[model samples]
Target: MKINMLAAGLLLIGVSLAAVNMYYYLEGTLSIQQVKMDSPLPVKVTEASSDKQWPLYDVKPSVGEKFAELYIPRLEQVFPIYEGTGTEVLRTGVGHYIRSALPGEENHTILSGHRDTVFRGLRHLKEDDELVVTTPEGAFTYKIYRIRIVTADDHSVMAPKPRATLTLTTCYPFYFLGNAPERYIISAKLINKQRVITWNPSR
Candidate 1:
């Protein structure tokens, strides 16, 4: 009986180990697939052509809550805007700085992104660089005013301003060799305004 019990226990242990291994393997595979699915599309938007707009892939902004159309002239890219700040959404496009509040509705409209990929190209900006954001109602232009560095834990950087404003964040040391400890911030202010256009008035 002891010999038989010993064999059974060993067999159960082997099965348990195999199950755990399989669980981990499947978990890793799913994580990779999520990241792959999150990858941004390669479409680019340039110019204010009435004939073209970014393919939003079924993104819908809430009614009474307007959406901003972001344009980085330097990159010749135009992307849609969403409310409530988050890297997950901003990394994909222009994300509203959750800490700052919504655009037009508030005094400041703060947006942030990953420095390495989404906002990586921002480092190329200089003082007075122009950033234009058009809403479904109107367009608000911003001028780059300054660049600064702050630590990762500095959430206060997204504080609201008394006047119309825009802020962009990314990692510091544009050419650093290792993980960046400081965050790079770009500030801007509203300039020109334009009316937002929609192809489907029925929607």
Candidate 2:
């Protein structure tokens, strides 16, 4: 009887620990939530775009630091983007793959997030859906052209592109109980670009 009781206690402890970890995984970005803009600013403000000289976009962030923000109109969600893909980095928000392009770099930019958290709404994204990505320098509009599920080993989805592209990735089967073997990918191409005035760095 004592052994059975001890086993039950251990099981309860394990479940409690798992719950704690899940909270951190899902709410990890809360600390950075204040940085999210109430709504993404419009890109065509003449004063901000007149000179076309953007210094904010050039602000180089240190490794694992906040680099940008993504605004999804479809999901009505804004998430902070951080540099580096380490566990600690992802805990705050989206992780920018170090090897990918930075905003306005005319190359591919790859971002990753947790399936249970920041990217949970991605499953609703459809082809042709438009989204905005804002940086200290400006705002960019991209239209999704492809949504696919690929094996985790797939690299072509994140491969270099001659033109500017944005890719958001998360574990597939959004509600899967454990680590999922497949990956969900949202691929978008830059359509409209604009330099904007934002209070991000200051706020």
The local distance difference test score of each candidate is 0.60, 0.77
The list of candidate 1 runs beyond 4 A from truth reads: 1-66, 175-179, 197-203
Off by over 4 Å in 2: 1-5, 29-59, 201-203
TM-score each candidate. Answer: 0.59, 0.82
- Candidate 2 weakest lDDT stretch, 10 residues: 40-49
For 1-203, candidate 2 gives per-residue lDDT tens digits of 99999999999999999998977876664633422335534333223343433333545678888867787877766778888989987887889998888865677989999888788889889999987777766677799999999998988887799887999999988888878999999999988777655535311
lDDT of 1 by residue, 114-180 (tens): 5545566787888998886655544557899888889977987777787778888877876675678
**How big is the positional error of residue 144 in model 2, measured in Å on the Cα after superposition?**
0.5
How many residue pairs in model 2 have overlapping backbones?
1
